[model samples]
Target: MMSFKRSRVIGAVSVAVVGVALSLLGSACKSDRAVFSAPEETFIAAEVDAGECAAQCSLDGRSVIRSCDGEVIETCAAHLACGGGACQAPCAAAAADRSSNGCEFFFQIPRYDPAKFDQSCAATFVVNTSLEPVEIALAYEGRKLDLSGALFRTNPGDATLIPHTGPIAPGESAILFLSDRDPEVAPPSPYDLYRGRIACPSGVVPALVGELPGGTRIASAMHLTTNVPVGLSMIYPFGGARSFLPSATLLLPVATWAKQNMIINGWEANATGPASQIYASEDDTEITILPKVDIQGSIGVKAARKNMPVTYRLDRGQLLQLVQREELSGSIVESTKPITTFGGHGCAFVPSSDLGPCDTLHQQIPSFDQWGSEYVGVGYRPRFGNEHEPMAYRIVAARDGTQLDYDPEIPPGAPTTLSRGEVAHFVRGTGDPIVIRTQDAEHPIYVGAYMSSCTEGFNKVSFEGAGDPEFVNVIPSGQYLNSYSFYSDPTYKDSSLVIVRAKTRGEFKDVWLECAGQNLTDFRPIGTRGEYEFTRVDLAKSGQAGQKFGDRVCRNGLQRLKSDGPFTATVWGWDYAASYAYPGGMALRKLVNTPLDPIR
Candidate 1:
């Protein structure tokens, strides 16, 4: 069995003490916060490369896609300068062969109706994971939604860099607000909107290359690229007078584009809104959709029933969004060539509708080749000082006659056998973590974790509300990584993380976590026995009792976590009747070949 190896730095060693970003120290000198310390070498040191390099479109055969003018250009493979508008070159590589760093990416920001959810802050974060500095920009063609004057802000600096724009130092991030907000409109001072954008000054710059649409909000298909590889993440937080429901997901680069995928999402029993599956094409592509439920087509599309396959064609930079009242889980999507796919609910009342409120769900779907046979489901620990609530989950089978076994005992309502394209729904109620495994590596499944709904009686709540419905993919144990650079949205007052790692002989392999200069130590074991264990820690809290809805803050921006052995973490934030959840990160290694045993 594959297991996490301990870091070579040191074993269970405690080191320097950093100042806490929030909360007062206890009288006994004990931190109310969980202590998760590790070897001194676990914390990543940021390095900056002062050298300069000329920019070239290094996505291989991918064209520049578009420039100021709408003229087509030749392919940019060998000696071609990086200025022409062309489509991506053909990529026959498998999805598992790709990594976090890549030159090109396609982003179709999920459609959020202002009528249903707040659209105050929508942004896509681009992080330079590589050691060297890289130039990043946005690209699109035949736009449906205009992005004339969208703005981006990097690290603050003197007048050396472009106005309001500076070099994204290694391990730093650039925030691109996804709105046509006027440049002269003077964004909020200190930028206290979503995710806390800092570095005030002339460095903010318009990042798109098109005509400015006067104050028009954006929800369209666009492409982004860097001179070198970087990481991309999307966060849509409804941060206004209404609710604070946020949807977030880490995007896979174009190098990981795959032709086959399955939609695993929450089941909404009512007609509140439609569950959505969106496809963004980087080239002229043909796509076939086999939805598990009936789709109420719109505009130029026709309605289709369950098990019926619908076909559509999309040009480079074009997008096709399919929506239905019923849940789209178990849907099978395949294309002639590689394309980017996303699945989630526009807004859903998870488990049941009596939970009072709903939240939007969004996640970039990985290709079938990236699916795994094993996973650890650790439910989020109780916040608001209430009893732990069950976390909802779904396991979508990729092959027929798939068998499942749990480490301890299977949760109630779990199915041991599932046919192809079948989805089994269950919930984890206990605080202990559960390890789920398949019969063999040949049978793989996609696992999705969901936060239980917020109600008056079921969960303790203040005016800001308790945990509501949020959805994020569960990272497979085989895809665990040693380090990750992730961002926690500072808007939510109650923010926490669920950390899971592999262990052996009733001992932990030792991993460390640091956010806002404070290192976390002391992770307690959960469950009776297994090769894995988990612990939940609070990154930011509300009032004294940790129940306040609007009193949370953290160190300005992105957080980095490193360890000697591999582990997985999930971030959760909630307040004011809204909440959001997403995995810290995962390695998309090709584990299975879908073409050989195609998903039916």
Candidate 2:
């Protein structure tokens, strides 16, 4: 043997390992796509400082400053309390009075992008009260946003406070920052978003200075654009990128307005008789319909005239034909006669039924069942000249066994009674010999053949193959059986068999024979008799025909066998003759206990 290349073997092994690893990696990556984690927070408040506490705060590692006043703060409380130095008692009292002549102050805060940064975006504000500590609450419209550490200030320079922190006291301010970040939060659908609203805590509107805060409060809504990554496929929206706009214009009732004037008028078209019609102009691509027809009979009447057009676009000829066909076919089918089951077959007693009289008979007799039995309940039109001709009739016996006794006492006009064995005799008598093997017996018997000359002759013949076989001038029977007394005629050339067995073996012996005219000799074996199982027999060859042997042994259309070894028995044909003899050829059977690998 030649040695394999070392490099080739190494390459093949590496490829297989890599393939397996890639498959596992792909599956793991698919699972990770749906997973989301809460955003992390890194910024924390350091200080709060003095009077008119800073309304907004920004912090670096070492220090924090009031965003509003640019004042530095040492502690979170002082920074939150007042961005201006600690408020004078007189000034605080004056601010608390609300009617005092002091300047009004306002501040602004920026929102941070959570998708990119871990730092909290926050703001602080201050309020002064001369009396006891006042409970000032903080609220904003963007409360649904994932601002986890965000806080609010009651007074300037207050350290950022987590949500639900106690209400702020007089002269004290609170800072707002991102706090509890919920990763599962999903953007609301457009329909729900349009109807959504947010309210601020009592007495907590955006600050007003000298001028009044007059317009409707502005609510900040975000519109996101998600782009498919390069080299990745985008499915829905059919494009690589999708964009959304959170404009106030989308909130208008455009759909409702359009429906009222444009769509509704076009739909309510003219009605002539039972059908209503609508037309659409090229400029208006659509038309809506609101027919006032009665609902009960409307479908039928509409269906009748559905294709008729008030406009000239409809094809009159096609529409008329379709309407006529539909009405005619529906009416005819509804009035047609029904079929009734009789003698286990569907029989149509009336002429209105599409099928002829013999439909039931043909349906009841399956092809396989008709193979062994004559007068098999199958319907066939007899040829004119063949009407009076005698036909061979084959009958099956009950499993308990049938008696084939000759009844000599019947009137000459009465039909004869042939038993199971006599039927076999008649089948063999005709040129077309058939073999029948019963499971109750060990050997197969030859059934009689079709007699063109004598239809009654088959019935007269005894099951034991003895009798004054009367010959009727009929078809094949008189030509073959009359010449050969043994009823083994091979003239017509088509010989078939029907095997009826309780059970078949896995292995059967293949018996071979040598045929010479009416003489048969030298029975030999073909194939491994004990090695392969045989289940069926093929009489297409002269050697296999029992009539060639002058003994009609296997003509009952069946064969029973007894075997000692664990082998299947089947007889099959090889060429066209086999095809003709058994339309459905032999079946190969294997023992259930045999290893499935070999059979498969």
Candidate 3:
């Protein structure tokens, strides 16, 4: 019998006291490099003989004295406020206000076995969107053994509990690297949030390759918690600096987890296979997988025929990985408890028959509860100097008899109606954005965007002019927000953004990109779609591709977008047959029957 070691850490902090007790979430590390330190103290405020009020300096050095009746007795400045009978710093006072979505997130870095060689490093970038300074930390978990050997092992006594413990200033961003490479091989300088190199962990073992047997115990999932709301983007760069093979996904926080989800993936690949991975948020999570295509079996996991359901169980911080020879798009996953899922190919050819070079594809998927009936379908910008080049897209139905209507006219090969779990594929040329909607909210669907293949032929290699395959989810009109805080990677040679905004009274509203130092007024209306408009911009600091990795230029660091009406955006970049794209951000508002979890 195989035995696995597990740890049960308390989910939340609790304290019993006559007066309020404030305790920081982390303690000082005794290592030679001290990240943060503070004496864990219990303040017995009730025993203090001070008068009816208390006095103290705020964390930001603001002075304040407040009465016990929750009355603000004194405030040092317009931005300062009295808290716990003392002036509070702007960050401490704004700590109560979280991001629009959530603060706690958990995810695993899926294996990205490149077609040529194996690249083992992945990065998770975080942006602080709140006024409060964010403290990022990982949930405590005991080391464990899997069917392979020890997974993500650290040095003795180094438990790997903290993730660059430090304050992330408001509107600033940080990127942490997770890799199996040597620890001394660190990312270039100027990354504010990087603590050190972390060991890479995952549900799929590299040695086992395509087999994920039952009861595999590996502590490879990352458990991130923040004092305030933040946004996360995960990147797995497959090719080295000389070549481009990177895949990324904008991570959704745990508060957005749902009991039901649908899979959207790229075409099958011979290298790493097409797959979907799910992470369990609570113990004893029972999952049902209904494959749209026949699924291959592992050692202890049975194979399931198309439409046949297979069941599996996972606990918190544990994950289930499913890899199949056939493309797994349109599959349905249901669970007894909420779970987070990601779907993509290890390395795939966007137009499977078009090109020679292929790249990895990955995107975190939203659940059925968050699906919407209306979407803005925009194609990628012209690639490789071909102004007439086309991009591919797919719309997956969530309910039976879902009818879809397109503005102006539908694309080349799109279907007007679809059955539950069925997918409709289409291709649109550059400058041909369209609006897609169903009859009503009763018929919701998921939409995905894809970049065309490199050069479209094996014999003709236009490495410098063309970009390989890349995948990004399209945000629904219902999930659009007026403001977004995003990041654009400067590592690529070219970075471009597509902004889709709703129009009012046949007129497009004003939009602004704060970091670009420009106000956008060149919005072009989507084909005969009177209610919406879109435009694409190259994200250059001074409208030039001079930004490099670790550069604090407006094009590389944290970015801000604002508009009068609801809108959504996508940030993408390409470098010689390599590309990456992801949604700027979206509101995870509930649109179905799944009960929403409270943000902790």
Candidate 4:
């Protein structure tokens, strides 16, 4: 089995304690933040060479994204030259790879060491983004890789670097090429999950691009930093199982992560299918899983099961094997220290049937403090072949006597009040988004959205099912964002963006989307419920060589989205078999993005 080797560092800086702009990290306690701590022999990267650096600089508080209009700011560290919105080092931009100090302390937590996992994959990169002139630093396998003297390219052709590279200039990015290796053991093992920290400024949207295991598919996602004290939701790509493309994205920041939680397995929805798994944030955290117990209530319902609880401990940076079950599959997970959790099946059919709409399932569940009382769960489109798996939203209440109200309302028999350990699932009649709110803020709940398979039919009649079922913990209204930069599955040719925002007066009109530097105008309101409204828009996928579609904005990687009001957006992906177009295939994700605003 590929497992993380434990190493703890006693040092000046901890990878967990990323020290840049520290005040913005929300908490003063180092362990409570998202990053791993650095070793004592660390690189004070800020101390860059003064040789030919941009003259003049400033430290405009860490609260906002500064636009560089070719002017030096008010003040800058003596070693840095500030201009063009970022403080840069003359030495940093002068070279691509250079090592200032040997950061040999190996205690950085949540690490990615191929040797420990018994893999020989050589991970490399060519980085490029809309944000240029960005310096890059990486701590890998107990050493800090230096790119201080490496090369940076604007239009990528052969952007390559290792361990580190000089700051990527604007209009420039680098490329990474990692060789896929075989597992050391022949016996089957759980999937290998990688964890580490990559840092740049919040204005810089980074991405780790490469191939996954033996699959030819591209494993990539936007690498946005999750340290914003106010907009923490920006970091929760819920990383693992980038199912839409079958790779890893980003995961929980230590701030919004929980030390304990529960998972109601697939058995909760379908006896024949719907499985689940648990992913830990850090290694060595002990997790206890209690079996599903039936609610003991008589009238209304409770939220959880109180049955057999099993305890297991995991090494740092490991994912528990996914277990598929046919009976009640709910399990409560309690951990000794803070950690992150993902609950979903390896692959299952919503309204399970072998016929259609099937894909792998994965979602990072939020800790209790991150739960919200108000939410709008908007389901995805129907499966291929006209399959009628209705969009289902399951609400798990955390308190007893919690009253739930729905906009566009629930069916006559569905109960609105739920006790602790109870779950209330309701189907949406309109494809538009539906709103649910608790009577008071005292009770927060978990809202998960499930899409039906392309195969299953509801009323004894069925349509052609195309893809598979998947689930994701919806972001809370409190974590809603107004601006972001995101990337779609580069492997999937077809894509759609589902946009959700609170319907105040004329706010939707201000939503803007830009691809390949062209303004998009195809957004249309699909539906609305109570205080929220939904909009759907198709994305232009890159077409054939030199065969251009007039004004087609179909480019992948590093796209931008911004709105005047707080909003939620998800990007869906499917196949390109021209025979099975857009809605024909299946893949969905709540887009993780970097914010354009300062901390709230």
Candidate 5:
């Protein structure tokens, strides 16, 4: 393991606070709303000597040698002269052995001298090559001996090591300097030496040597060296201490069990054990072991079991292990058959009606109140027309259910349209029965109708209507009023009409029109079309109407209508009948109490 340490510089005074403040101020200033103006543009040209250009110019710098069309030609120029061209440096010598089929070779060690032992002492090994740039790495593990060091390489004739920033180019050689200790301490031990090199276009094999306990030289221990082919797989063993159950039984396949124990690099203990159980094969290929745990006490002890089957591959006599553990917690045993065959089924509701005939009213009018009294619950069925093609038609309200005047001239097979007056009448329980139309022939054609109980004058009236009364009331008051006043009564004051905005088309589909009448105490919807009608008497004039009796009455009517638009006419004039007018057929025939005295 390598640890990196950094030195911190101490200051005579604490400047961090001021530094932070300055930093914040700088950021604020940069982000402030300020503008900067650039200086005027200027251009100039100059000449330099050819030798000066080659010496001072770098690949990244602007080396101007000529000018064309008012643009400077600053290329990687070797010379500044007008006709001078680029030049190349001489190449280095290649390796001596070029006939070898493989580019692999072993490292040559120099004789060691005890007199030369020093902390900074290092040995340099050079390898000459003609191959293109390649990568190289060195690794070693010294357990019996404590030799720890690093390696560095330098360019030829350079006193200092060349930072290994990039690869070495062709025809160039690399020097690997190895030191047992850092430049400041002397080595403390003499141990086995191992070194190797790998060049492009070929592979290299390393040589290994070890020393006995008594310091007896083990001459050229080449057999101990491991030569890994390019792209070869390697598995290093590792071991650690852990607590386990004493009676636990590990069931694993032969191959995976092999990785349980082995000496890793002849240094660290690679087997996880205290040695009660072990697994081994006749050949060195498979090896495994299950170390037993020594329990302090047998109180309430239970046996635990696990089984696992794993697979792995072996490359170049190296054992690669992969282990998967599957455990059984309780005594219960159950087996399941493997899933092999499968089938699927699906279903859909086959409605008997065509798209245009289905009871789409359910989607449009969710409640019975949405449709007036003319329609009951709606039913749909598909039918084939003359061409044998599917077509749907809506079942209109029963003949007895609709009123005599309940004939709506809606376009056949298309959505029905009603005038504001008609809509008001329907909502007021005095209009014609509801009708359904579908001219498009593609959309659903169902219409719903339900009876609405409303009080008309002194009697309770039953209105025969159709479809959703709620839908009839969903129109945005603003757009509805705007369109109504603009078309029906241009003189109508904008303020007299209260407008409402709708968020969706469904809400806008119905409009609620309300206007106070002399017979009503609250505003009420006009008809099924969301239209409200205010007679001239129902409207109130402005305050200036006080100048004249007619104006005063008109203003009073306007105020009453505007304030109580949703009430009945009779209720509206119940308190101020003297100021209003009524015909013999009017809902409010007469007023007992009058607010306005007989004109003088």
Candidate 6:
């Protein structure tokens, strides 16, 4: 856990007003740092602590009063100008507000301590649309390299001069092979968000390689950006102390970051147990962790347990790891500013004691603001059967006073007065994996599915002795996408399948896949979760090539999907070749009507 020196904001003494309780979240080093509190209700002018402040004045509209143990500081108005940077004035004091997304950004993923694993990293990037060829460059250890040749095919030919004609077209994908290494310094690791102006020359969206350097170990949580809407995922494979490997897709931009989130440990029944990791990225992030014991124990008729409000201020690139030997152990994490969260079991068992599919699993939890009451969770039914494979689903509430009416009634029914940072846990219960929005929409709820480990290959039923549970973001129908260009990992022997389901009755008017050249003829029903239908496309049957699914020259790039209306699609990869189960993942939704650029 690396730490940056905080740039404390000191100010001139001035008239002060009553203060509110200050919230504090922190760094790894607690000893040398001093803690202080804000002035109580009636605060007056006080001297500024020049070198003692730990926070810089916020430029974004995310400023919150930060405090140490217990000390009084300047007023909110004054703190805004303390960081020493020349930023616009606070919006409250202005006649009109003006804050918008920046054109350039470099996300910082927390670095993993090298001492931990046999270290290896693998990644791929997919630009969301077919746009003018954007010039892309790469920066590693301070050395800049031109990556446009391998990643982008422009009108001005490259060294090969083969007259570029790749998935450089709309709805297509490409691979980034990064073997370029420089001597100045290794890419910034752990906690530090590295964004070099020189790294991305043309200033195409902040992003990442070929032959990718051999010593590559993306141990830390990763941060990638694209000039256009793009998606990328990195995996820290199984290794020492980390037999349960974890891989996570980067969440969408801060424009969509939410303040309230319900932790959904997307795992299954009869597992070794709950090992949850809570991670948040972005500045001005303040999270309050409501442990499970506190929630369940606070049930009506039962005396409330003594659970203190423990909040953490998360810096970009930091992950708050909370692991415990408890059942579905979860927490309600609330943030002040827009922040992204990821929760998962460190290492879990599918059938509890079964060793084969027991691997690490995690997914970036979507903000409740984006969650929908209606969700259709498609469970995996291997071509061959694994009778006992089970799944668990949790409904997380984003706000208090949420009213929930289920299609398949949940026993005690959802709590009448669920508050922020609370959750209701339940299994598929003979009913389908769908949560129907009923009784209320004032506060949204997130429906998450957890699948147990399964057979590595079709009917290879001997239970490979160990399998890993997998978690996925069961996107809401409201967020269904009409078009997407995604790829399958060639590292495995089997190809993954894409599940596209209709969001509403007649929602999926028509469907098309690149493989067939026309509307899908095999569209089928997926349990009628809603008054709609769904269909699946098996890329394996399309054909296989040395580097992709199609033949040489006609190589299969990212699979393109276009439907009449909006629909949600998820991809599941089987770890058959790895002799283990790979927790499947969902594609970054590029839905219909989504803005090409986020509003400021």
Off by over 4 Å in 3: 1-101, 112-117, 139-165, 182-219, 238-243, 269-272, 457-465, 504-507, 541-554, 593-600
lDDT of each: 0.55, 0.18, 0.58, 0.37, 0.17, 0.38
- Ordered by lDDT, highest first, the candidates read 3, 1, 6, 4, 2, 5
Quote the positional error of residue 40 for candidate 6 in Å: 62
| lDDT, candidate 5, 540-576, per-residue tens | 2221221122212222111111110111121011110
* TM-score ranking, high to low: 1, 3, 6, 4, 5, 2
Better of 2 and 6 by TM-score: 6
Across 110-202, the per-residue lDDT of candidate 3 in tens digits comes to 553322333455656676654456676654243322222212212111223133335766555655543334334443334412212223443
Please say which candidate is ahead in TM-score: 3 or 6: 3
Q: Write the per-residue lDDT of candidate 6 for residues 128-224, one digit (tens) a residue.
A: 3312222234444334644444352211001111223233432334544332212235544443222110121122222233212111121123343
Counting clashing residue pairs in each candidate, in order, gives 18, 105, 1, 82, 60, 34
Flag clash pairs in model 3. 384-465
lDDT of 1 by residue, 1-600 (tens): 112211111112111111111121111012232232323322211121233111212122123311112122344443222211122221211121254445677765455333333223456766555444557667656533333334343221111222234556555565665533344454434333442222222333334322221111212466776665566777764331133456788887777777887766545544245445445554567777787788676665667788888877776666666555666777778887887667676667666644566667788778788888988887665654543566677888888889998867877788889988887778775265677889876788988887766763222332236767777888887677555556555455666777887662235556544442333455655445656767666655662122111232233135456554567878777766677777766767667754524325
TM per candidate: 0.72, 0.13, 0.71, 0.55, 0.16, 0.57
Give the alpha carbon lDDT tens digit for every residue of 76-141 in model 2: 332222112222232231222111111221111111111211111112212222122333322222
